[model samples]
Target chain A: MAAAARVFSEKGFGGASLEDVANEVGMLKGSLYNYIKSKEDLLFAVVRPDADELLMKARRLSGTDLPASEKLRQIARVHVEIIDRKLPYVSVYVQEIAGRGISQEWTDMDREYMSLIEKAFMEGVEAGIFADDLDVRVATRCFIGSLNWMTRWYEPGDPVRARAVADQLADVFLAGALARSRN
Target chain B: MAAAARVFSEKGFGGASLEDVANEVGMLKGSLYNYIKSKEDLLFAVVRPDADELLMKARRLSGTDLPASEKLRQIARVHVEIIDRKLPYVSVYVQEIAGRGISQEWTDMDREYMSLIEKAFMEGVEAGIFADDLDVRVATRCFIGSLNWMTRWYEPGDPVRARAVADQLADVFLAGALARSRN
Candidate 1:
């Protein structure tokens, strides 16, 4: 999967050949087919772990008894961590998801996880933990967009920068960037 | 350029053809060459306006006598408004900018505009108009990422929704989502 991700990242999903992936992993083309059905399948195989990890994190965080603010903070951190850990796969996922032949299962999983975040915003607003007038859907997307954008700039193995970005972004999402006194 | 942008948005950059763009604009493929050198040239033609507009806005706003907060607010609105106005071209720009054949001119322009935003953050901090501890580069990218993500969801011709998104996002960038009372 790692080799496939590297191949797809370098040559886009349409441009990458299954043989290139096989070469990267030291497998013969025929042997590769034994493990994956097609190039599309190989692409999905590479990205599924990212989707699974995200859904796993979302479910676990949302299932906890934390307040909405805390939940959002955790969500933000976990999201950054996932992207940091799976940079190659996530990059391919972001670039290719809108293309033809992506699985419905992937889209369904994405929707489910997004709903969990939206639910968090709704709960936050209802509990007076978030602004009452907040548009939960757009706000949820704003939060998601902020974190996902990290993929374009976040470097792998830079734990210091990673932690700083996660903490700072979480702070912004929960409390805005304005100093407390100014607010 | 408009016809090329629509074609590129519908078909990924690699998939789009000069013939397709020519057909959209009611011209012959051979005639398109009279104006564009290649498919890649056509892409740069379509996206150059967005880059030019961004740098133009950034330079103009950064030169203003407005406070950092006001400057940032206007920057946010203008940023979103441009994406709203040029959705198809901007969408192609986001997807293809990192690819192999993209023009250096585009990347240089993008970096310049981003640096302008980073400068805004730095000035804001120096003037005590923003939090003292802000990481100007990351914060600026976060701001850019938030606005750029609108290309994914901002529906064209829906002025009402566009205005709401712009205002809501600007508010978040300036003050964040936490209620002032909570702060």
Candidate 2:
């Protein structure tokens, strides 16, 4: 799975071959087939687990009794933690899932993942925790966009710095930079 | 140039061959040599011009006596407009410019382009036009990430929608979700 994630993240979906994954694992291509069904299966194996894990965490956090602002903060923290923990898999998810119609099941799973985030934002807006005029759709995209790009540059060993960055992002999103006292 | 952009964007720089570009142009691979010196030359020709044009626009906009906020808005608008206008080339730029040691010139050009946006953000903060706590580095990445991802989803014929979306993104970045009155 690690080999598959690394190769897929590096070469993209259409560009990577099963043999490349096999070579990385020091296994014969035929031996790889004994364990994984196909290239698509390998791609699914690499990304789907992380997606499911994220959805689970998101669901657990959503069910919390926290206010919307804290919920949003928790959501951001969970997302950053997941990316930091599973950097290569998340990298594969970001790079491959967009264009390649690997499977309808994966696509639906990916949408459900996004819907989870969107729901959190919507909940915040409805509860008057977020600004009234906030466009949920655009804000959701921006949140996802910022999180998605982290895999490209985030270094895994620097969890403290990563967490700090994530907090800053949540801060920027939840509260505008204007001096509230002045207003 | 358009052919080269399409081929390179679709196949990536390492994955694409000169023959692919030649085939896209409905010409023999050998005949392509009449127009360009090499594959690297073709890539530079397609991408550098777009970078040059963007910098030229930035230079012209910088000369204007606009306030920092308006200047930043204009910079964002220029980014979206350029991506909308020259999508294939921009797509190529997004996909291929990273991880290429031989393309140091293109990499330098990209850094220069990104620095332009970063400078605008920093200037806004300095002028007290933007929020004081803005982490200029992260904010700049968020801006570029949002703009660059547009190539993955943007439909060129829908200029009205594209511009509207760009405006929404600028609003989200500059003012954030929190209302101005609250700020």
Give the candidate number with the greatest lDDT.
Answer: 1
For candidate 2, what's the TM-score of chain A, rounded to 2 decimals?
Answer: 0.90
lDDT of 2 by residue, A125-166 (tens): 787766777777767777777777777666775678778778
- Model 1 scores a TM of 0.90
Residue-level lDDT tens digits of model 1 in A1-183: 999999988777766888989899999999987888998787877888777887898899999989988888888878788788888888888778722234687667767877999999888888887777777777777777777677677788776677778888867666655556743
TM-score of chain A for each candidate?
0.90, 0.90
DockQ, per model, reads: 0.48, 0.43
For model 1, the superposed segments whose C-alpha errors exceed 4 Å read: A26-31, A98-103, B19-31, B98-103
lDDT of 1: 0.77
Whose TM-score is greatest here?
A: 1
